[model samples]
Target: MTRAKSGKSGKSGKSSRKSSISEKPSITADSSTAAKPSITSKSSSDKPWPYAAGYDNTPEVLEPAPLTVKGTIPPWLEGALYRSGPGYEIQKGGRVSYRSRYTSNDLRERYKKAEAITGVTFCQRDPCKTAFQKFFTTFKMAAFGGPKMGGTDTNVAVIPTINFPGLMDDPDYKKKKGKAGPRNLVMTTDGNALQELDPITLEPLRLFSYGAIDDSLNASNLAPAHPCVDPDTNEYFTVLLTFGPTALYKVVRIRQSIKGPEYEPDLDVLAEITSPRPTYMHSFCMTKRYVVVCHWQCDFAASGVSVLWYGNAWESFKSHDPNVKASFYVVDRHQGRHVATFEADPYYAFHTINSFDDDGDIVLDIAAYKDHTVIGDYYIENLRNETGGKPPQQAMLRRYRLRNIAEQAALSYGKKGQPQPVPAQIDFQLDESVNFELPSINPSRYLRNYRYAYGVNRSGMNKTLIYDRIIKVDLDKIKSGAKHSSSATFWMEDQCTPSEPVFVPTPNSTEEDDGVLLSIVLDGRRRTGFMLILDAKTMKEIARAEMPEGTVAPHNFHGVYVPNSVAA
Candidate 1:
């Protein structure tokens, strides 16, 4: 993000011109080549700028960070600016060496400016650094996206979730209940990992129980996949909820009127879409009239396993026909009807829906082929059909755009320019380890209409290239589709695995900054989590609140941005 003309930019510009930019390198000439200078510094007709680039030792500063609320930065936050090296990258995870203290006080004004956008009320919360709650489930599939919900006021609703149990034979008189953080619920198979507690107070929301879906679960064929929310009608929905290897395929519609602060039970199943085989649907977004689901066609590596279902490969699977046309599903959430199924050719234009990053940007999962594993080389069709491509050896991020992809695919089929995709400027950065994972994105466009994106870097190293920085993208940029841009900024502290950051732009009133964001950071070795406050415009780290002792699930399925008035 570039600085505005008024403050930071102007000051930085003048300081840069006056300063002697280059630092005489404390260099030990490795060879005689350096001893014998090739020519002179004036070789070029125009001498390099006096401040030509070099390691300045001085902190490369962005505008002074906007101020955070007085209580925003917690004591647990490790300061920024560390000496790069050793004690940095540890086994369980990297150890934070340096940290940044609260410096810039302008955040208050910046935040106040941002607050001008929203017409809502919210609490000035000092978020806690812990997974407020955790639920275990038995479903074995590719991934668990953060949860989705809708409604407002004291009356709200959510798709409470938990990890699916494993081979453990623990049953209850009834079903155990837990709420996912939208995309909550991790199937760890370890009983101890489940946190059956109240999200708000961290008390026991319910007892974590496990058992068969039912005596008739085998015949019932159900799986609680993507539970969604309808804001317009204040209803919650999901595909069929089944038991056993909890990986369900057939799509059945379920819904209920969201009850405000009441003991309301889950909604009822209203419709069904029987597929030829199990077609896994990952994250779901929405349009004015329909829900957009990332339709995944694959034979799960852990399908029927009592132990490893949905835990296997996601990069390559082959269908009966390598190419019949694969695409995304725009289904009607109200009536459960398929509005339009659109597919993009892999060879042409395409973007696998990625999740959100720290700055509220999209962290796209690039190609069908993952390079990290044995099955890495396979492309999307091969991953779907089973036989194709070579694994790149672990997952790698692929850069793509919707417009370029749609146009490419259109031309491949002899159709062009009819209607090209105006993608938000969401580009994928190439990393060596872990193919970029998709993040959860909120569809609401306050103004420019940014495509919210998220991603988690599984690389163990703390390097910014390999990771050490969590990314967030906007839809406006995604639609703008800049092939390469630095706008998709990052949010990360030393050695912390950010589950997924939630963007909460403060409302218009007696506020402070351009916008403020809240996020959870799951620190690996520390066995804890923390809440982070960030500057929306610059994507700079603002403040942090450390979570209590506990290894919260390393990641989250999803999270929500709750406004104030109803937070009670």
Candidate 2:
């Protein structure tokens, strides 16, 4: 199956269940109105700036506390929404509980000490004041221990403990099996460490390693922040990177259920690729039959060892090279081998919206930027600046069609028998108005063709906070050469910024868009946060669970919603 066919309206895929949001008006405020819309407020003489207050040193809710509901929450919505931006909200038994905590509290304190900054970090100060210091720091960092970077800052993505062996050891965790079976959870960052959190309390248990799953993966110190899970097979796929004279990349797979020794998982090395220069990849793409690893133009300097000397990953990257095209390494899952390589224009992307096999071709959709400047856009100083920072940069949605990749891969071994670059054509590009990022889709539609995609809208200009709106787009319209008229919808409120929208489908639903969207919104005016629930089909507000007075939910990167049935 490929992208949905043309002539189908975006709303045609909605669930047959009646929507409570039908009577509510969709939020389509004009630019002027949306910018300065007034919100109810309690007067205060010293209110901190909204963006700064929400992002910097926000308070944490150590205990579960009930929140005030503004409207009716769907009784069918039973789960805890956890965000790596450091918080979670649970709705169960006609009550809602919100909690927030810092996963890297100790790590943050260690950096504050002047002489303790010995490990490589992402964007912290180098700490190497002189050439002699740089030499000693590099020697100490690369000596014996694993990649000493991002200490326990597993604030990126959330994965279920059921995906890995030996993680669900808690008898309580194992006994409380949901429809999918009993499981705990873990949070991950760019480093090798995974912080396991109690699914019920949201308390981090301990720091673990990828090596715990299999000894072969012990050499890897870096892995993709976003790992892929095949919905059909329940297999987990992640790429492990070991930096050395030659950077080595190994694509590994882990089975859903365990059947052997506690420590020994059904893990296997699917493919391996060695490169002289390693590129920084935040995420990758996967379909039912293939796993695609993208090597963009951004590469680490001095074969990645520079991170040791520079004291962080961000300081060691070489600038984007315009002449070098990006490479896509396609691994055939059934055959367990690297089958093809495709080339595309030099561009940087942080997330893959979705992917699927279309006939003989592979269709991959991603949010792309012209260069890597988007990385720097997240600096604390930049994010705190309301109007002085650089012009807001937006990521546009781009679709690539790798035509008959297996056949093209086979031809590479003919005659000269040397691999050549196979061209990957741009099948579609969304208009600039969308400015999409932090994309999400119906969980059931993952690794399969579906019409709707939900994400944040960052097209607003000169604003301190990013992503002022949430959006829903019809992928079928974009594929049918309707870049200008792609069916897109938005939900917005004045003085509120939203995190990524998570789509939770109705149980056993047939329609692709039959679900509700969940997002945590920081209310600028109130200086507090709330859980904003929207109708996935109409992009209209269904209900909201507001945090207690003076409670500010910190800005987060990614999140996951585990239904009570999965694991309470």
Winning model by TM-score? 2
Model 2, 312-376: lDDT tens per residue? 66667898789888988888888787778889989998788999999999989899888886666
Candidate 1 Cα outliers beyond 4 Å, as residue runs: 1-136, 140-226, 241-271, 301-327, 334-336, 344-467, 492-496, 509-514, 522-530, 547-557, 561-564
**Which whole-number lDDT from 0 to 100 does residue 120 have in model 1?**
11
Query: Any runs in candidate 2 off by more than 4 Å, and if so which?
Result: 1-48, 112-118, 126-182, 256-263, 412-418, 483-486
Clashing pairs in 2: 85-556, 177-182
Error of 1 at 379 (Å): 22
> What RMSD value applies to candidate 1?
20.6
How well is each residue in 1-568 modelled by candidate 1, as lDDT tens digits? 1110100111212110000010011110112211311212221344321111111111222222221132444223222211110001001122221111111122223323554211111111110111111111212121231122111001011122321211121122012222212111221111111222122212122221111212221233223323444444434433432223434322333222144222222333333333333433323434333444444343333342312322322322333344533344444445554433445432211124433222322233443432122222222222112122222233334443222332333343433312222333324444354334434333243111234544544444442122245565544553465533343566656646564444454454222224555555545445454556666656787655453454231233344443212211
Residue 330 CA displacement from its true place in model 1, Å? 3.7
Q: Which candidate is the best by lDDT?
A: 2
Assess the local accuracy of residue 129 in candidate 2 as a C-alpha lDDT between 0 and 100.
21
